[model samples]
Target: MKKLPHYQAGVAVVTALLLTTLAITIVASLFWQQQVQVRSIENQRLQLQKKWVLRGALDWARLILREDGRGSNVDHLKEAWATPLAETRLDEYVENGRADTEASDATLSGQITDAQSRFNINNLSTDGVINPKEVIAFERLLTNIKLDPSLAAATATAVANSQTKKTTAPSGPSIVTSAASASSVADTSTATVTNTTDASKSASNTGQASTDAIPEVQFLRFTQIDDVLSVPGFTSDMLLKLRDFVTVLPHATPINVNTASAEVLSARIAALSLSDAAAIIASRDRAEFFGLTDFKQRFPDKLTDVSANDLSFATNYFIVAGKIKLGRSTLNFSALIERIKIDTKIIWIREL
Candidate 1:
């Protein structure tokens, strides 16, 4: 090679350094891009897994309904159902090679109910007032269940407030207070008056002092459950606790002792503990309770407050909650069901 000038040699070195830098930059960029692509793929896979798990939950719910002979009435949105599971069991269900036998153990739950029974608090306003009887009965129901007294008071106030019309400005201050003011004062003075009045009226009408009398009043329906949050002592935790077993329906249908879970039955009858109620359910699952008489026969002393005439084995309403978990993903699903005697026909089916 011919001898190069000093400036030419410097230019050659600079060009080589730039080429090396460019090559390194390109390699680094490719590596980063590959990592981003991998993360994106993983995210997509996780989403797919979650979707599949939800589908699995639906399938599990369907199976439970079908087995219970209540599959035909799975359309109602207020029915009650539940299944709890461990995380390890959920992982096994998501895996392909695992036996389907343990699939039931994968956290799944479901419920069904008639929508009409519950009072939708959202519907009530300063204009539309709830029935006084309904308010009293609801409060009594809460009290019977040993819910926080403050919550019950708050619920009554919310309902009353919802229906109360805004008072017109007084034409002039006078000795006689306005009707609205008087009513407000009265409500504050006698919070329990409504319950007492209802009990007396019920006793008068039926000629029997019965604990079941309160249930006869039209109940708050599905949408109304949300209104409970407005009640004074009702916390998010309280609402969650009550959500599983209760329903607001257009009709005041009695809860079926046969199908009602221990949590619910215990709420209805004070003497029944959750454990004792569960034992009763387990026993009845093997054989249907013939009647309240039979129930009394089983636990004569245990069921002191509840009578045979007050109980029913036939259930018209149910709730089912379904949860499915696959891999790291999970889905929660709920449905209300009504038991109707009719020819079987499918109505609506959602995959996820």
Candidate 2:
């Protein structure tokens, strides 16, 4: 009986050890899981914080643009909006006037680019019709940039065809009949009237409004250069090179002579050589063109072939890019702003 008690004691000790081992494993697993959850929450918090900071930066940029628009009609490199912010810490923006304290360790830097200084791709069409002149100018730009000029026609044709597919009436018996009847109209005026009627009927059938009644037919606008991926012959490499000198805007934007590069100026004027473009840029620095007359005097008979509607001394569109780094996370913000009269509005914002 005494030997049986000793054996029972041994069994009790083994059971106690096994229970303790299981308890330790459960506790360790719970602790590890808690740590993982805390880390995930911290990462999400940081991401949210980064987004807020970028939004604040965008607001700041819009304020600057508004102030600039109120002060001057012309947007030049010398303007305050044109100035690039250096990489700065979040603490510097604090009202306490103390750096390296209180605020989190975040760095930011950004620049505002003039979107109107470059050629607008939307200008290739006026009211959905391909402009042969604009196509030729684009060809000249491609030639100047040492790319294949034939790509211009290919790009234009693609854009035009895409637009036509969107707006053109489908081939049908009624469409054929209308087309034939409209073709039979003898005089130009009668033909115009007949075509307008058919267009209205076609628009009604498609459930789209007829733009013919409007004085100006709205051309398609592209918000980003990447939107041109559908264009034929516009490879990524071609877009990269074209990006520096071309822009896609919601409306037809004229080239700003004060801000345009030599290539743009040369392409804009059929007769202007590279040396002439350089001269115009240099002269503008001395005395900026206050009016079209001043522009004429500066370039003298140089831009006779260029239309007055093709040039502008002021800009209305601007792009603001902001970068924010918080903790281990970084955020990039890009905004497109438009200045109408004295009011400035953000057209769109993109985060990268």
Name the best candidate (by lDDT): 2
TM-score for each prediction? 0.48, 0.74
**CA lDDT of every candidate:** 0.54, 0.78
Q: Positional deviation of 74 in candidate 2, in angstroms?
A: 1.8
lDDT of 1 at 266: 58
Q: Give the per-residue lDDT digits (tens) of candidate 1, residues 1-352.
A: 8989999999999999999999999999999999999878765766676566656655554455555554432222223333333333554444533365644333433344433223223322223354454344344445545675345445545654544345577696445368898787678658668788887898899888566645223333224355576555677877776665455433345446656666556555566767777888788767656667777788887777774433555544444445555434556655444444432222233334
lDDT of 2: 0.78
Output the lDDT of residue 73, model 1.
Answer: 26
Q: Find the candidate with the highest TM-score and give its number.
A: 2
Worst 10 residues of 1 by lDDT: 73-82
lDDT of candidate 2 over 108-136, digit per residue (tens): 89999888888888788755578898888
TM-score of model 1 (CA atoms): 0.48
